[model samples]
Target: MAAPEPSSPAPDLPLLDEHRIAIDAPRDRVWAGLCRWSDTLGIGDRHPLGLLLGTQPRRGFERVELVPERVLGFAGRHRFSRYRLTFELAEITPVRTQVTARSNAEFPRLRGRAYHALVVGSGAHVVSVRRMLNSIRRESLKD
Candidate 1:
């Protein structure tokens, strides 16, 4: 079955959104892609988004957790949206890996519900992550 539509934060559980995707590639290859992508976000890298989002265009995220090819985790704060993001990657098999992206956002007090109503309904978060996973897969397949 197809995925369900994205919805507003659960009234009971605000401030979080999680998304995951599995890539059809070996762990090492996927890891290389992830590292390459993140490297391009660091200072002296060529990615536009990194320069825009980073304070000094250096390593934008804190390496909260890492375990070589098996796991990688990062935490970062966004300047424009005032949101905290956590990224997690885990190797599920020799030929597959799972990527999870979580976002912690705060909307103005008493306006969270309305903000979620507008943002969650748009499914932008899911689409972005899906594209990220696809890009990782494609990059991993490269020589």
Candidate 2:
């Protein structure tokens, strides 16, 4: 895995951010599930934020790197602003996976920053992301 880049100003938020969760699933299963989420959720061309904002889908792709049962990285871009959302994973047990997602972008001023922050930092957005990932993990375990 590559070292994390320093956090930068998110155009929508005042602070760069990181969010993480642990799932009870084998690393391979977890990794595979994440790779397939775009098609599974019918968001193949849509930026995640677009879906969150109730806009139509746009073009984007999830970039996934696999390192067996030890590590995995999942990243996708927000189409309009090109913000990157990245998730890094570490296996803590045979069936436990720890994952962190970081949000980063370059915003010029406070208004833009606040706007982006509001959208990204909202509780509803956070919960939606968590639920989506958890659902992916659950589905992956079934195969």
Candidate 3:
């Protein structure tokens, strides 16, 4: 019998969305906030369409890459969108960090493409990104 093909860890995807924000918090503090916030995505995020369709916040993706307080990345499939989200943190001062969030994604079929167009490409993704940044800022400032 022939051996089966090795499974790929993640599919190579195309760039879809990217955004950045500066946080007045230390890199380590922001990193800690990010880790905690990632697990709480679905708890309070509720899109109007999502509510109409009963879409729940997705489970957190596994951290595919990590560089301590500098970089963090994750890739996964949500609904029909296969994508990656990476966070890059640069320290600008003793208590400030510039953070960038980059997203790369691929919609394999018509349904996925439509979902991305309606939800992501229509500027909702931007809102979502900003909310995420605010969450990080809030968490990082906590004692």
Root-mean-square deviation of every model: 9.3, 6.0, 6.8
Q: What's the distance in Å from true for residue 23, model 3?
A: 1.4
In order of listing, the candidates' clash counts read 0, 5, 0
Tens-digit per-residue lDDT, 1-143, candidate 1: 23223222222223567777788887788878876765543344456666665532234444544556654544443333334444566778878878776666655554545655556658866676567667766777788
Clashes of 1: 0
Residue ranges of candidate 2 with Cα displaced over 4 Å: 1-15, 40-57, 60-80, 109-111
Instruction: Point out the higher-scoring one by TM-score: 1 or 2.
Output: 2
What candidate 1 gets wrong by more than 4 Å, as runs, is 1-15, 40-65, 78-81, 110-118
Question: Candidates sorted by TM-score, descending order?
Answer: 3, 2, 1
User: In model 1, what is the error at residue 134, expressed in angstroms?
Assistant: 1.3
Candidate 2 residue pairs in backbone clash: 12-116, 12-117, 13-117, 45-58, 46-58
Question: Per-residue error at 4 for model 3, in Å?
Answer: 24
Shift in Å, residue 48, candidate 3: 15
- Computed on alpha carbons, the lDDT of every model, listed in order, comes to 0.58, 0.55, 0.70
Q: How does each model score on TM-score?
A: 0.58, 0.59, 0.75
Model 3: per-residue lDDT, tens digit, 23-67? 888888988887787676543344454444433233434457677
